[model samples]
Target: MKTQVCIIGGGPSGLMLSQLLHLKGIDTVVLEKRSREYVLSRIRAGVLEHGFAELMREAQCGERMDREGEIHEGFYIAHDGVLDRVDLHKYSGGSSVVVYGQTELTRDLYEARDKMNGVVIHNAEDVTPHDLTSDKPYVTYRKGDEVIRIDCDFVIGADGFHGVSRKSIPRDAITEYEKVYPFGWLGVLSRTKPVSPELIYAKHPRGFALCSLRSQVLSRYYIQVPLTDTVEDWSDDAFWAELKRRLPEEVSARLETGPSIEKSIAPLRSFVAEPMRYGNLFLAGDAAHIVPPTGARGLNSAASDIYYLYHAMVDHYINGSDEGLENYSAKALARVWKAQRFSWWMTTLLHTFPDRIPYDQKLQQTDLEYLFSSEKALGSLAENYVGLPF
Candidate 1:
């Protein structure tokens, strides 16, 4: 098999990238190690920036999102016994976020592709990219017991952080910056009434907690805890009780819940790798960088990736210009690093440390208090919350 570009992983990043390129007249194919059902069923983060919505429309993937997506003006930041509202729409040039899960986005894009005669393959035997600099790169894999090999011009590593694409690049060429936070977010989804109209980042003596929603009917929340803490230790009732204690009393009035359908603890961390492009394989999304969900950045960063890469590929194909491809790494890293800073800063201030400096504790509270008191500080936060000017 042969293609202009072979994308690994059928996740949001890869799928969206392929769709964008297809619209631009570039031919590409995506390979997924996971099944179609698995990809569609894995419920994850569900927020999209307003600018992201515009891009989605441009890529022809925003019909359902337009129909059902909830647009948020900004977020509520609660700390030190007070709540400070950040107005993102006013600050980020009429920008905010829409509530839509990554899984549903993928499913929607997949269906769109099928309607447009686009390719999204599941159970992709085995796909490999080796000896990247050659005219035809070696890609080998197995389907059941049948082995196959593919040759392609460029290989895209859209598979996630743990995939083989990263490993394919030799060591020492990679420079990484990372922080494994002392806590993880125990996320849960329920058929419950939402606690707030907007996303809330609330800090309590217990730890950091978030109140958000999937819809008017279902609510989502995250609680900070030790990386080693297991859900088994916190029964469903205990979880609700803790949330009630941490959230504002007014929240309790509307905090009704049905049986929990999704629950998992995701470790909080900030990670990035340099030189996203190595020879023939170009990495995107989680394959290139990871940001803690503190700032609601993981998926937005991935979407940013599709826009960047799609433009670069268009330049290469239509104008016979490789300038964009040559600068892909440096271009993506600028925004990638900023997100790292935001996530790291938010995590440090929100999560309590084992030996937290007394002064640090005081400073965090002081900053929180200052933001609520100063319109300027709150405005700055509002812009960043909607996402850094990406």
Candidate 2:
């Protein structure tokens, strides 16, 4: 089968790109290795940036989200026994974030796309990228051991960090920028109620802790810990004790930690690959970059990648203009790098550093004090936290 764009991986970026292009009367095909149920159920980042919410509605994927998505006006930052809350809507000119998980967005997009007359081949095994310089670029994959080829004018890799597209670039010229932190986050979903009214980002002597909510019913929380610590090893008692210690005293007393089934221990990291595009193949979302979960950047960055690529693809097809595609890498990198820096900044400020000497800790404390004291510094943090529109 032939299409204008062949998108690999049925995650948010790939699915959303297919829907958007379909809306524009552009023909595209999506190939996913996993089942539809698996794609929609895997848990990931929530909290849609202001721009992302606008586009979701524009793309006609927001009907259910509008009904269920929790509205977050801002978040709180705590340090050195100091408390300050920046109302995000107050700064972003009334724009706000939606506390909806990435999995929900994927479900919305996939169902929306499937309902359209568009084509997506799930369980597509043996997929391979081919014929870059020709009139058609394609992927060869299998369906129950039957190999078939999908031909397209352009290809987009929205698979993720471990997918095939990132490896397609020549090893020598490919420059990978990365930083792996000493800590990891143990994220938990509890049947218990949230301790606070809004999200709390607290920096304690123990480590960083986050208190966020999925709804009035489900509470999502994360605690900084060593990457080696297994979720299995973290018994109910151990988890609550650690939480009680790291959480603010006010919330600590009230937090009703209860049974929870969904728990994940993800490694702390900040990584970005240069030139999201190489030849006829383009990379989007985690395929191009990753950020430490501290900033809640991964999902938003993925959305931003597709937003850039859609216009670039439109330009190529409509006006015979290669400029958009040619410059796609440069344009997308601007926002990606911004996020990389911001994610790194958030990670450094929130987490305790084992690498720091006594003098270094003092220096960091001095800087942290200045962050809360200086209006410019606080506003900068506010801007980064609320998000920068690309």
What does candidate 1 score in Cα RMSD to the true structure?
Answer: 1.5
Clashing pairs in 2: 125-142
Which segments of model 1 are wrong by more than 4 Å?
none
Please report, in order, the local distance difference test score of every candidate based on alpha carbons: 0.81, 0.83
Stretches of model 2 off by over 4 angstroms after superposition: none
Candidate 2 residues 1-390, lDDT tens each? 878899998888898889988888889999988888888778787888877887788789999889999888878877666556767776656666788877788889978986996687888886789976466788888897688988888989888998887887778747898889998989888877777767888888888988888777788888898877899989877888898888767678888888875888999878889878777899999988999988878898888898888888888888779888898989999999998998988788788876767886787678777876776776676577666877
Top-scoring candidate (lDDT)? 2
Residues 301-332 of candidate 1 have per-residue lDDT tens digits of 87777777888899988989989889888888
lDDT of 2: 0.83
